[model samples]
Target: MKAISYSRYGGPEVLEYGDLREPKVGPDSVLVKVRAAAVNPVDWKAREGYLDPVLDAVFPVVPGWDVAGVVVGLGASVTEYAVGDEVIGYVREDFLSRGTFAEYVGAPVRTLARKPRNLTWEEAAGLPLTGLTAYQVLVKALRVQRGETVLVHAAAGGVGSIAVQLARHLGARVIGTANERNHDYVRSLGGEPVTYGEGLAERVRGLAPEGVDAAFDTIGGDTLKVSAQLLVPEGRLVSIADGDVVSYGGRYSFVRPDADDLTRLAELAEQGVVSVHVFETFPLERAADAYRRNEEGGTRGKIVVTVAWDTAGPDA
Candidate 1:
């Protein structure tokens, strides 16, 4: 099977595209024929060796976690899905290797969910990681309730955009921070747009004068500090980007795979309560380009890598 992999940790330059043995389906896993994969900042960060301390990386590592594909084979214990089932998964295993950036991935049942029928394959691929992140932080960590006010940092980016929609879906009034150019986009996601940077806290205060009930930070740094000040004394705060949030009495959230949670996200997508925006897409062989685009940052939505199994061209 064809896949993109790297034998050593480095930048996108180290990625090599070629043939590799197909992944093995274990008793708790299913082999999926990849249709599309989404690029997350973590993909590039892992390539640069940032996650080495936490995730062991075997040589010739395939670097993707979000995939929308069809199940081609299933493990003996995998009763939740069968061959020919279209699914989406945040296929992060205990170790780094045999990832979704390939023609096939052996995904554990815990990581798989039926793909939202309402979404395009690229959109479905984009949802798992970002949707799970937003859901975990807001619904689970912050416990945002209806009629409350919530502030989301980087509101127009991949995860933030979903956070904005999810917060609104939960009946919370959402205030999102983005660049001047993305303010309108944030508003379209049902968030009251506030320009980020220097006076972010003040801007949020102006929008929710009584003080926000919670805050979700996708961009770390002083943004966490700003969130701390913008919230009410006991307001919850969660950050996906910074661990130092603990010092501010806030929780640092790391997204994990859960079939139940992924299913709920799919339900939300099917109900039109949330949607994924695909800012751009590249063929599977051009995955390095997808990483470069994600690294440049400030994309309004997700970047996807489409797979074409029937052809030998770049699109294939």
Candidate 2:
């Protein structure tokens, strides 16, 4: 099988495209013939060894977690899906290796969900991680309610865009921060746009007047600090980027794989309540380029890497 992998932790420069053995399907996993994979900041961060303390890295690591693909084979114990089923997964295992950047991935059933029929493979690939992050933070962590005003940091980026839509779906008024260029994009996602930096708190205050009922921060640093002040005295706040949010009486949320949650997100996509914007797409072999683009930041949506499979074999 052809895959992109690195034998050592480094930058995108370390990534190599070549043949590798196909992943094994365990009792609780299914083998997905990769159609497309999405690049998240965590992909590049993991490549740079930032997640080493928490995720064990094996040599020749394949670096991707979000995949939209077809099930080609299934484990003896797998019953949720079968051959020919199109699925999307956040295929993060307990260790770092055998990831979705390959022609195939052995995804545990817990990580798999039926891909939204309304989305293209690239868009479906983009949704699992970022969509789940937004859904979990707003719906579960912050418990945003109807008629509430909520603030989302980095609202034009992947997760924040989804957060904006989800908050609006829940009947909350969304105030989102982005650059001046993305202000209209944020508004299109149903958020009242506010430019980030220096006076973010004041801008949010002007939008909400009485302070926001909840805040979801995807950008760290002083943005989280600003979120703390923009919230009412007892408002809920959560950050996916900063752990120090705990110190500000807010929660730090790390996205986890939940088939039920992923299914709900798919439902939202199918219902036209939320949609993924693909900022760009690259061929599988050009994954390193995708990583470089993601690292450059300021992307309005997700970046996807498409895998072309030959009927005879993997990229035959």
Candidate 1 residue-pair clash tally: 0
lDDT of candidates 1 onward, in order? 0.92, 0.92
Score residue 29 of candidate 2 by CA lDDT: 94
How many pairs of residues in model 2 come into backbone collision? Answer: 0
Question: For candidate 1, lDDT tens digit of each residue in 1-316?
Answer: 8899999989899999999888878999998899999999999999999999999999899999999999888899988998889999999987888889999898999998999999999999999999999999989999999999999988999999999999999999999888899988998999999897787777777778879999998888999888988888779999999999999999999999999999999999999999999999999999999999999988999999999865232223
Worst lDDT run of 10 residues, candidate 1, spans 307-316
What does candidate 2's lDDT look like per residue over 1-316, in tens digits?
9999999988889999999998888999998999999999998998899999999999899999999999988899998998999999998887898899989998999998999999999999999999999999988999989999999988999999999999999999999989999999999999999997787778777778899899898888899898888888889989999999999999999899999999999999999999999999999999999999999999998999999876654334
TM-score quality measure for candidate 2: 0.98
The deviation in Å at residue 192 for candidate 2 is: 0.6
Compute the lDDT of residue 3 as modeled in candidate 2.
Answer: 95
The TM-scores, one per candidate, come to 0.97, 0.98
Candidate 1 deviation (Cα RMSD): 2.3
